[model samples]
Target: MDTFKKVTAIRGMNDVLPQASGRWERLEQHVRDWLRSYGYANLRTPVLEHTRLFTRGIGEVTDIVEKEMYTFTDALNGESLTLRPEFTAGTVRAAIEHNLLYDAPRRVYALGPVFRHERPQRGRYRQFHQVSVEALGFAGPDVDAEQILMLARLWKILGLKDIRLELNSLGAGEERAAHRAALIAYLEQHKDILDEDGLRRMYANPLRVLDTKNPALQEMAAGAPRLLDFLGEASRAHLDGVRARLDDAGIAYTINPRLVRGLDYYNLTVFEWVTDRLGAQGTVCGGGRYDGLIELVGGKPAPAVGFAIGMERLLDLWEQSKDEVVGQAVDVYVLHQGDAAARRALQLGEQLRDAGLDVIVHAGAASFKSQMKRADASRAAYAVILGDDELARGVASVKCLGDGSQQAVGFDALAGTLVDALSADGDAGMPEPSAAPPV
Candidate 1:
């Protein structure tokens, strides 16, 4: 008997099986299309970077840096590294490292997995994917509004509704510093009510304490000095500018005073697209202007703003809002019996694929009814059966799975016949077939 223990996927990291991967792919394609429409190019960064890159860029006191980062020491070099907790820091690092902004400000985006050591829940995972979009070296509220509008357009394209926008401005450094001083004093007065987490972060990151979810401290947090009250004129103007643009575009938003994003780098104009459906994880997407992050990440001083969409959360909402089934996997499923018929089936599949059709040729020995059942299970639009008699006659028995219609087409005319039939049914224009030949 086999005695070895079976291994399973690590906790908090789940595999995307075929059943659900289709939805993931569809969402990803929509994201790519939406980003490209705004001229945002793709930017990919390595998953690992030096530990200080995050510690300094994301802030030493932020929860992501202090608690959630997956950090390790490299045995070869005796240096510490971390799987990126978020994309902003790494995107900025890449922009500076490659001098991408030397000629002009760039709009680039990254899509990939991010790592964090956190308890997994529905729509939240230790290994989750993100579509992070950044506009580097652009220093105006217009760009900020543009990013917000871009998100609105995407939601419309995705047919997602009831996801409202909440906006806030962290203001510039001096303004926030003033707010921070006042906040710390307020928290000091309420130290008796501060929970362990709030007390620990009260001084180092008092702004975050206001964001605490502790039910006991809700009243105290609400009573703390609002950051908006302390905004300087320039900071207020920037916020006003963004609001004006959003108004011009007919976008509705609320100025959430406590919407300070959980990052040290964010200053000025932070926003989140939140939904009520996801329960505790309400924020589907969040980002803000981090004007100083470029310099913080070892780049020359430059202004930048960006946002990240948690794919898992976005997908969860997408599944709830949309009901359209994912398209059939293949345009045609070829089934055959007997050696000669199987060979002909393979050849016919290749011919159909050459004319821009997805073809899956059945393999192994199975009865005609069994093959038909397999073809139906594949969700193919049409099934081409090549029995020995049909192979001898140099024709195929084409059956439409959708309408239960069948026709006999000669080998030379099979591709054109199917194409014409599919086009008539409004299912033509199939994507290029896979490079690997049908098995």
Candidate 2:
């Protein structure tokens, strides 16, 4: 006999259990619906792309490119391929390859898993999911404000609190270079305090040193040259325009000069929606204008602004505060006892499903009491009892799970009856069954 060995999922990577996947599904649907309402079309891109895409798009000196990407070479071609660390680069690559911006701007959204070789924590994971929203070809501050306001709507929809917005303007390339030179000059004098990592990147990408988590460098990093002061006339005006619109909409924000995004392509407006609930991974969503990304990724020069929310972070926050979303609950649970009833139950399931109802027919014959238990556990609004008597009469006893009321409905009436009961109970979120979640 062959010996077997135990295997486990890769560390930092995780499996979303069946019980917990409901919240993910609900949150995804909620965000998708909200994005669609704003005329954003769904965009799907490949998970693996040319390695240079991220290194060039996100930046060479960045942590993601330097230490976190899952990159490997193709055996036959010798070309480097990388599972995406973030979706923006892939999204932009797709836009360029597909010529999506040939005529006009496209408001697009994508949700998928991104791989990052990082230590797993409470809200951070090696393989994580993110929902990225991108607005391409729009150059005005109006679009920038719209993206921020859209996030506010998301928080409101998810019933999230304690999340606040922080904004900054990285200025244009010229202004950033000016600030970079000054920053390098100051850091040259403070060499003693520079950590090994900071010393290495002092000249290559000095701005990222400001983003360090090192307690020893926090005060010193804070006092580093502020990019906000280096904003040229155009950069300052662009930021002011965004702020004015935000002020008009009553969306409050703080301008943190040190809030340079971790990506290289970002320029002009940048923002992060942060919360205290998610431990050190406080940022739930972060994005800003990446006007140079399109050009860098071989597309015609175009302006773009968007953001991505970590699914893990969002799930954590939702569980802590807004755990009110209805999840994975069917509108009807069809219970059956014998072979004959099981056959009828399957037929009833199809009928209810065709009539636009969420039904989970009890599979594999079990005791009536056991089936009822399963029905209740399903959190279904109704438990459909298919006993011998009801089967012979071509009727099903539909018990309202929320209440104790029970009634007999004919096979033809079961779908409508369940629908009415679900409607009466205000369980409209469960309409037809959705596609299986990515558990």
Model 1 Cα lDDT, one tens digit per residue, 120-146: 998889999999999999999999999
lDDT of 1: 0.89
The global C-alpha lDDT for each of the candidates, from Candidate 1 onward, is 0.89, 0.87
lDDT for position 229 in model 2: 86
- The residue pairs found clashing in candidate 1 are none
Q: Give each model a TM-score.
A: 0.94, 0.94
Clashing pairs in 2: none
Per candidate, the number of residue pairs that clash is 0, 0
Per-residue lDDT over 19-110 for candidate 2, one digit per residue giving the tens place of the 0 to 100 score: 87788888888889999989999999988899999889989988999999999999999999999999899999999999999999999988
